[model samples]
Target: MKRDINIFEFPLNLGLKKKEHEIEPGVRKLPDGFRKFDFHKEINPQNIFRLDAPDYSMEIDQESGVLNAEGIIEYAKEQADFISENHKEDAFNIILGGDCSILIGTALALKKLGNFGLFYLDGHTDFIPAHLSETAAAAGMDLAIITGTGHEKLTDIQGLKPYFLEENIYCAGNAETDDDEYVQQIIHSDIHYFDLYELRKNGFGKTAGDFLKMVYSKALDGFFIHLDVDVLSDELMPAVDSRMDDGIDYTNLREILKPLVHSPLCFGIEITVLNPDDDKAGSYTQPFVKNLIQIIKNKED
Candidate 1:
């Protein structure tokens, strides 16, 4: 079936205040020397799809560890409805996120349609419960909340059990500064962990090929690919809340994702953590967006 694609942008910064950054309107404008890096200039009319998340007010309470859970649920419901309506027409949902927490809503939406596998690409595990989180950031608990392991309001947003089984989850290129307990949790969880050192030694092409094969074998249906900018090397992608120096490099990322982008089982892709504050006058973000668009367009062609 021919695929219809929708690109949705969630721009709120509710999850980042704890990290000391501020949010602003509009795409971060490129500085004088960075003007040549605009990614929108390369858009292909035929294969591209776009949408924007509703502008809901957001607040973060560090003392109480309470996020606007109700608002998040409402936003998630809207996203779920959009996906359900579009799925009937054979369309794919490509979400650009405000923060990693957006995954909770996206995953909830996907779960409503039946079973789907998650390809979570990030530097951190994102499995910490709200109470235990050092930073108490909502983004930290995104994956756990969707899997029904956190607060009731966050976990029960979709009126279902955990979105997917732990066995069905896959994390690629993780190189976080997690504590020992977090490390043990990753080692113990059913989620397969492919460390950065392994990818470097085995080469991204080989590593990604093996991972995709494993996913396809286990996934009876299709899967969604979620990309967090923090997964990229800090040198190349400085526009994220979590900047790890030893993460995947741009070249390796392209190699790792190309096969999956073209895979029949790959339903959609979500790109997150495009924090304009950390970016150098949009210097870092434009090229990354260009590469992502190119990857998707090449697959379409």
Candidate 2:
């Protein structure tokens, strides 16, 4: 069935540690930034929901050892509740994130709904323990938190620990393979891992096809996609918080996303880590907004 589209804007950016020169991460501007290029108008979503985020801060929680842990948990609960209240089975949700940490709330909401698979596409694995994190930012280790590998406070929200099973997730497009420790962490986990080199070697379309097979084989209730724009090459999209050298291009992006976006059991996608503050001229964001709309619009056709 072709599902209608719904957009949810959660502009919380507290998950990131403020850089030395900047006041805070600028990911919070993502939703409005896309709208500036007519992203929302082209999709013409069925409904629009937005949750205003708290002002940015860089406090490290003593209890969880994560930056802004308390604020992240607070917003995550509200995000889950908001999504639960307005969720529609037949509508595809396009969650515009404040950062990668927004997955925590959506994971919680999906947990309440039923077992869900996750297709994680990012420039980093995001599967490190808090102790190993250089920044102590939740965005750096969200995959670990959601999979019950962190402090109980963030991982076990309301006793729903392990929002997503390790084996049920497919983490693709990691470019940070230079660090053995960082690479080894996710390698030890059950999530199916595909670094950027391996992703291209296997072929983007085939990699996505393989993930779909897993979703069907597991008979999951539905699945959510996490898209961190840094997965695109620095040449193509360099407006992200962390810029890696080489990554996929727009053609490769559509090759991977089209099948998944059009799938019947797919829930929706969340876009993260695109800092509009860096792309003041909108050169990168313009093409991003255009290609993404076409990918979604093709689903209806």
Candidate 3:
């Protein structure tokens, strides 16, 4: 049951607003950044594909109430097509992302394929609607959009509303708990929510095991793991756009990802939001690439 890995590089940064000092969100450099550490060479992916992204912009679409709505939608369509054309049923796909917004394209591709579940692992809930988001960055509200909570233009792309059904999602590793409004969105929804505190209490390995049970029980086409590097502790991974105070460590990451990555039903996983600009020195990226390679290869060996 050794699945060959196929890597897709989607260097899109249209989800976030550029800071005054920066030209664009540094997340766009994520794919190349990983390459600097020879992540692809070490993993030895069967095929590698790269999708060029649009230039950075901060235009807020008045209709959709999100930044770069038109650009995001356009890219998502292209992304879906690219994925559908190259996606192999047997090989595991690893999508390297520019930001959390990359999920839209991945989600669209999955929806077109069949009934799929989502394992959303992020430090922030990313469940806020357009009005609630001060920045109106799609990256901040991607989960909500994918789950059919935002404007119809973004959520109902190609008539696929709610790319992933709420019941089939397991959103874990949220550390931003103080904002009741932010935390309550997912809590109220059908998504199985697990904040940082609850995750540790239930145990990381056990939580992953529990999620696997649901995947199996549903008899889904497959599940995709969404790994936002920001889910790592601030001390260990501070190169992300938004930094949380405390998060799970490397061991916890491995424990949670092992079973999910090894499961035969897994379609693939996506890595997002590890900004190279913030990690000018390869210190953080080095360990991240090393740990991730071990996790992915651990199942094969």
Candidate 4:
């Protein structure tokens, strides 16, 4: 029997540590934006599941990095439980997130089953510490928090510190790492990493081969993938929350992604930060979706 792909939609802007006024708009439209295109035919996923958080009452206390919401943690717990008990056991999960912060909830779900690694493919390191950031965007600090390296409260989500073991994580395809602090944090930490230049220098196949080798050698139960579309350079596909120049282009992206998407070791895949507002002409949608389906077919064959 053919295997299955289960897609999850998380539609909310609540996860930010950044004040709403400062955040770039149109992220909340991601889920809605996705609906404009026909993924049902394109990717042909088995089922699409959506996880919705309760209406936001969250406020950020910038000094300490707390979200300042009473119910948000509980909401995350519920989302985690839903993924673990219902969807995870049955299908290959594809999560469409409002922002990278969705990792906080989904990673917890992956953790519940067994220890899992992360394949973070994005433009920014998103390794900034919450306390150090006044923008307060949880999206920026997701990788840090996921690895249990950020503010105490976020690191300890559900009492699961170091939600993902550093040795098991591979942060591939990060661009624009010039920020001294973000670079410093990643350097001091144990997460396996490859910058855009490093990945391209070796080519996508070798990078994927080396990355998977490193991941499988550790012998973790499974791993989840996080794809921030901003990792693509503006020339090919520019519809993103943030753009990174001189990043991977479409051809190399497919080459880099195919093996991993096809890898048996991959448990779940999440796509985030595709801002529909940026792509009003729908010029980039279908081909991008098609490439994703082809990525999966690499595994199927």
Candidate 5:
């Protein structure tokens, strides 16, 4: 059956510390970036819906470099619940996020719906604790929080511990870096961690095929897809708070995502951490939006 695709936006920069190349995380300008694309005119209004999201900027913790994780959790939870309550079971969702921490609420909403898994694609493991957060971006800790590994406030959201089991999660394209110790944590944990290098070695198409099988086998209520823009190569997407020298390319991302999103078990998707400052003249936003449009359209067909 063809499903409705609704869009929601969370424009803020709750993550980021010092800038590189003065590359600030101006997530607040994300909606504006898309506006340049005139998304409303491009897609059919009958199939696309919009949400009246918060219209203000949130202050980041000067020392922590991330907005208060707990505080954002409370707010994001409400947004997720609202979508769950208002949308149909088959409605395909595309959430535009300020940062990856948005997953805490998304996972919680899935918890309320029933058993669900997570498909995480990013540049870093995001397993750092409060003390080990080198830049203090809560986005960096979202994965650990979703797995019920960190802070009680996040781990215990809606009284759901380990919201997504390690077996139910398939994290692809997480490139290694020397700046964080999260790599060691993933090596020791039960999470299905596939580095960008390994994915390329095994081939993204082959690995994505195998990964989807794993997710379907473990999922009772399907799964959610989280795409952190930083997963793409620095040369292609340098708009993130953290950049990796090597990573997945845009063409490779589409190949990996197309089949998985076409699966019946794929419930929704959230794309986060795209800094507009780096995307001058809608160069990146235009193509990104085009890909998403095709992805959503393919889901209905």
Candidate 6:
């Protein structure tokens, strides 16, 4: 059976538009400037998944504070249909996003097949609820939704919880500004987190190796790796919405991800929040996508 890789392009910015009470009024009033980036032009077209039809769509309801959860699920069902039709073959859903919120839809689609673990690599905890969020951005709540804890529409994707227990989730390279409530939740839950301070103390290679061993030991049938580019330092990857200087460098980032990509148990991967408006003559963003393609191609070889 041929291995299928589908790239779902999601470019909506609804999550960024939502206002959060916790954020300072000054930050909340800032103009929406991140949307100007052209992700389609920055990414190498040849490296992405090709489709006979459009692979991206969106619908947002600000009054209800519900993102296009229904539309996302519908698109996910389409991807599920494709998987059902091609069940004899191995398939991978590579979701390239408008923002991180799209992970909810991808997770929903994967849940229909069987159980799977999640590898959430990001700079923030992304576990904030809509009401408690410092910035009520839907992107910030992606992980919470997948873990079965946020808005009903989000957590109830496909009418089933899409993720494993909190213990099954793993976070790599996060910053210090994470919310206190979210931090407490992580401590109480089984989720594993590797902060920048910890990475610097242990070394990226060692930390990644340890994580891989731990993930493989869990006996999960499959796993999905979600990469939020903000996990990289601002110097290396400046195209993300949440620009922060405190993240892993490019070399270390690659070292951490290489083993996961090579693992047979990794069913799919998603790369989110690549904003071209912040890109430097397209020089900074292209290499990352190229490296990702190389990693996938290496697996093929």
Task: Pick the lDDT winner.
Answer: 2
Better of 4 and 5 by TM-score: 4
Which 10 consecutive residues of model 6 have the lowest summed lDDT?
Answer: 24-33
Q: For candidate 6, what is the TM-score?
A: 0.76
Quote the positional error of residue 190 for candidate 5 in Å: 1.1
Task: Please write out the lDDT profile of model 4 over residues 1-301, one tens digit for every residue.
Answer: 1458777787655655333554434565676666667665556777777777555545775544656423445656777887876684546777887777788888888877788878888887887776666566677778887787666666787688878888887787788777777678887888777888887887878877777887778787877889988888877668776676767777787787777777777787888877666777778765666666667656331
Q: Is candidate 2 or candidate 6 better by lDDT?
A: 2
What are the lDDT scores of the predictions, listed in order? 0.66, 0.94, 0.93, 0.72, 0.71, 0.62
Worst 10 residues of 5 by lDDT: 48-57
Stretches of model 1 off by over 4 angstroms after superposition: 18-41, 45-66, 87-89, 299-301
The digit string of per-residue lDDT tens for model 6 on 1-301 reads 1244555544544455422432211111111222123333433233343222233223455543545555544544564555444433355555555567667656765677576777788887777667666555677778877788766666775578644567777776778555667666555667787667766787776765665676678777678888888888888787677778888776776677777766667776777776655564656665675566656555321
RMSD (Cα, Å) for all candidates, in order, is: 4.1, 1.4, 1.4, 2.9, 3.4, 6.5
lDDT of 4: 0.72
Which residue pairs show backbone clashes in model 5?
Answer: none
Candidate 6 stretches with Cα past 4 Å from truth are: 1-6, 18-93, 299-301
Model 5: per-residue Cα lDDT over 1-301, one tens digit each = 2666666666645444436555445765676677678764554433443433343334655533455654566666776676677657777777777778777777777877788877788887887676777665677888888787766776776678877887778778887745446678777788887887777888877877887878766646788889998888887777777777898776788778887777777887888888788778666677777766666665321
Question: Where is model 3 more than 4 Å wrong at Cα?
Answer: 299-301
Of candidates 2 and 1, the better by TM-score: 2
lDDT of 1 by residue, 7-78 (tens): 555554444444423434222222211224644344322233233544533465443464655566666777
Q: Roughly what TM-score does model 2 have, to 2 decimal places?
A: 0.98
- By lDDT, the candidates rank as 2, 3, 4, 5, 1, 6
**lDDT of each residue in 110-167, candidate 3, tens digit only:** 9999999999999998999999997999999999999999999999999999899999
Residue pair clashes in candidate 1 = 7-51
- Cα lDDT of candidate 3 equals 0.93
Candidate 2 clashes between residue pairs 3 or more apart in a chain or in different chains: none
